[model samples]
Target: MADVYDTTYGQADYFGSEASPLLARYADWIPAEARVLDIGAGQGRNSLPLARRGCRVTALEPSGVGRAAIKAQAAEAGLDLDIVGENFMSYEPRGVFDVILCFGLVQILRYQECASLVTRLHQWLRSGGTLFLTAWHVGDPSFARLTREWERLGIRSFRSPDGSQYRLFLEDGEILKLFFRWQTIHHCEGLGPEHRHGDGPPERHGEIEVVLTRP
Candidate 1:
């Protein structure tokens, strides 16, 4: 995975310097001094902004390059960001966080892995803490291509166009089902323009954006 990101991060601006609009939109849900865990926090896109907002952020990333970029950006901004170079699956939470960011990661894991990860995340959040997530859904136009490949291979995972990466796409209600034990604050799934990672043409995707609070 590190090798994959090392190449991707080097080739394209997948993790932008600025915070994503999704994160910014829900920033108020996080208190001024809240503790935040940013899983798959590549290059501090969300971490830096949350830190600037007075949140103490712990950024967990798998790639060394990504972690280095995040550290450098945090330093340039003179912000204190706890950047951890580790995969989230093997990472042990030190303490409960007031808010957890899991953007653009759920769709990459196997079905069971996604289930287990969310279950662990539920335990990692404090009562009433928020978990924000974004993932590709079956409604996206890309879903048809991925589904065809999955059916051909008889597996849930689909390889990237270059065959260097594999990702999973969820269907309707999957996200809600995963967090059925929690209180859903917001959930939306529909067609949306894909993030332009590199100078590629803008494409449409079936995507799901969700915010849930642990009870």
Candidate 2:
């Protein structure tokens, strides 16, 4: 299947060339040599930075365009990254990781797929490993527009008119319940920094951010 991000990332500087602010904010918490997995690693923004910090980063991007950009940048920077061009749902993890990043990822899955992916994350993370996650919630401004104008799959889940995109927003405190057993290092729910994708207008997302450690 043709991935949507292949088109989006093909655009000049789709997401720009910066690591996520949330990653920088929590950088001190990660071990310098930790094994890391960056899911939906669009344009390698977060992956490149982590690799530069001496973390062993595996960038999993389904978009061929995005993967090429990552490869190009990694080469220019002399950074060694394991770039995987496969959908997360089909990509089988080989070994446990010390840190896993899910920035701007979970919102793309269906409700059940989100839960299933959490279970997979639990299995992929080593004991005492860390998880950094950011996802949109129902309070996001776009959620109202999506639910009202798009094809509703379920509560807070919608498909775009042309059937090219899917989004599932979290309810307040909903994602927290899934990780009750983990030790929470940080957790917050609210609008995140303004950002844009492709040629879209400046936008904001009501998001949930969490940093947790496994037992």
lDDT of each: 0.81, 0.89
- Candidate 2 lDDT score at position 52: 96
Top lDDT prediction, candidate number: 2
Sum up the clashes in candidate 2: 0
Question: Which pairs in model 2 have colliding backbones?
Answer: none
Q: Residue-wise lDDT of candidate 1 within 32-149, one digit each (tens)?
A: 8999999998777888888998999999989888888888877888999899888777899889999999988877776667778877888899999999999987776866777655
Q: Could you report the Cα RMSD, in angstroms, for every candidate shown? A: 2.3, 1.3
Q: Supply the TM-score for candidate 2.
A: 0.95
In model 1, which runs have C-alpha deviations exceeding 4 angstroms? 150-156, 159-164
Provide TM-scores for the models: 0.90, 0.95
100: Cα error in model 2, Å? 0.2
Off by over 4 Å in 2: none
The CA-based lDDT of model 1 is what? 0.81
